[model samples]
Target: MDQETAMRLLLKGATAFFLDVPSGMEFGIDMMSWATGDKFKGIKMIPQGIHFIYYSATDKYGNTAPRCGFFHNFKKSECLVRKWDPDKEELLNVPREEIAQYKTNILNLDQFLAPYPFEEQTKWNGLSSLLTENVITTLCPETTIIRSAMELFPASKTENVKRRRKWGPIRTDDDVGYDHLPNLVPKAESQFRFTEPPECHYPPGSSLSQITKHSLDSSYILEKMAEKHHNVIDLLAELQFCYICFLVGLNYESFERWKKLFQLYCMGKDAVAQNQGLYVKFLLAVRQQLDTVPEDFLVDIVENNNVIYNGLKELFRTLESGDFVLGDDLKDVTVQLRRFLQQKFGWEFNGLDEDDDDEAPVIINFDEN
Candidate 1:
């Protein structure tokens, strides 16, 4: 708008000059995909935060490899330059002097490079917030570059039967037949994996048998989940990261991985019953994240039997059952979530039965966030 503000943004935003990017291939940061034209460089006023840059390289025969992307935490006014390696088919960082020169000449270069799509910034923020710099650094141990992070597994016939050609207009995955295709498996051994791999993130080797009714305390359980970490913030970040990696990133392994963890806590009937304190804290964290999940992401989940949704639904049902009991804090979080889901998504939850003549349930309120 104003000169001063424009100058500030120019100083704050980062520049990405990718040289020799192949024509006909798609490149983009976050939500915006760019089909490179004559002047193929990309310049944008990127917010100083963690972002994902991805591309799909295509050949003449219409065949393509798995979608490749990388995560970066940009600093204020950071200038990044990369040259495409035709052999590796990846972007390699340019030399320091070259980057310095590019930064100096950015005013002239602005004419050629495309501006960031401001209209898509809202959607980009929603997606990018799911993964933070710490979370990315922790989850992507082998490589932050997703192409290298992807593990190839043999696909099954069942997978082939259920697989669709397109999940959305954007081709997040390569169009290869599942039977003949290799899986784009996310690494479970990485820092993002549930402490109990393929299940809940309870302390290592801890189980329901070890957890007793007397030992149940929401704060204590949260501490256990966090362990040495200051708080459960890291755990929450991981949950959000895994979910996005699965849903938007088109990593099936990540979906299954997130589901396993989600099901472990939300759907673990005996586990939840025995450890209601832990269950409540977990749900609180999940409720906080629910707002961040976009409607499209939810639609994708709903199309796939709504595993997370159903799990939470079942948890609510269990909590309302006569046999189950919850602390005031847990009950407050559950009720708030139930009300929110009902208003937002038309999900209905039945409270204690009408026939049962009992004292009115006490209502305790907690911060939604």
Candidate 2:
């Protein structure tokens, strides 16, 4: 089929009519973004799935505001209408009456709509395949909008204000003269509700031995987090959700949570043996996520003392240890990931050095009478 005919058929798939967005404003769906021209109205041929629609409003002086985005699950042949509020610099839902008119005039307006970039569909699918409506509703801010600069409010309104206020007069060597600065917290209604890691490494009333073990191996915390999910796949879904939020939405909070989740999964040696299927899926997800990371960011990882490398090494050691009889599927993907890392970043996972702090055994000395 000709390109025009193919686009026409795809346009019949799903359409978004973005009305009155200023020319030269940044607009994007999924992975590709472009500066809209005077004639641009919106996007067409969007595939049927949950996709992120994001844009930044450009001012008269050529200054651009922070990017804002939201997720929408489009259905086949569905039409969506959004009007850009120039004064507020935000996308607002069009009135139902006006939406009906746009639907009627879609054929006439088709010329102004840009076709979705199908070339990115495969990459987008790899990143977002595990994302579900449940994951969106659970983690997204109550306002259902994600902004690169998250909204914040004075810390006084937060639950931890009392504790934070108590530290106002206390000065630590690390304070660095910023202690006088007023504390701010993410707006309650605008914060991503990511699952927090455990506050305590061990359960209450645990013996000294159990506490020491839990602190060294995060399997107990992993088990605690697993109880909150329907299954292990749901846990993986949250990981994917955080990655997309950080990668596409530009939310650093999501990125931090993603690292924490990755660390939890990697550090839990017992959890790995208990859930082989989950580990297989986890390795696959990690590989795909690493593939998408920018080269500059990977360089930062190497510069920051090989944070990712160390995490993967710990995981590899756990899997390779003769104690566990791991599945072939798990072993195969693990090998593939190791090979990819070696070729891509020249990372080796043979073993940690005997003199390395991580490998050295801890010794507690006691004074004897």
State TM-scores per candidate.
0.65, 0.88
Alpha-carbon local distance difference test for all models: 0.62, 0.81
Tens digit of lDDT per residue, candidate 1, span 1-369?
687876677767987788888777877776678777767877667778877778777777857666777778888889989888888887888889999999898888776677666787776665455456766776764556654246545445444343433332322335444333444433433323343331233345556765432132222333455553334556555666666665446565565656655654554455556656666667765765576567887878777766766667656655776366667877887888888888877776555244325332222111111
* Candidate 1 residue-wise lDDT at 113: 75
Off by over 4 Å in 2: 1-8, 154-163, 166-183, 352-355, 358-369
Candidate 1's displacement at residue 306, Å, is 3.9
How does model 1 score by TM-score?
A: 0.65
Model 1 regions more than 4 Å off: 1-7, 127-131, 153-225, 228-230, 264-305, 315-345, 351-369
Residues 1-369, candidate 2: write the lDDT tens digits.
Answer: 598886576556788989898999999998899999999999988888899999988888999888899999888878899998878889899889887887777778878999888899988888887887877888889999999997776666344455455555545547756646666767879888776656677798999998777766777777877677666677788898888888888777787778778877787878888889889988999998888888997798779756577778878877887378999999999999999999998888765432356543221111111
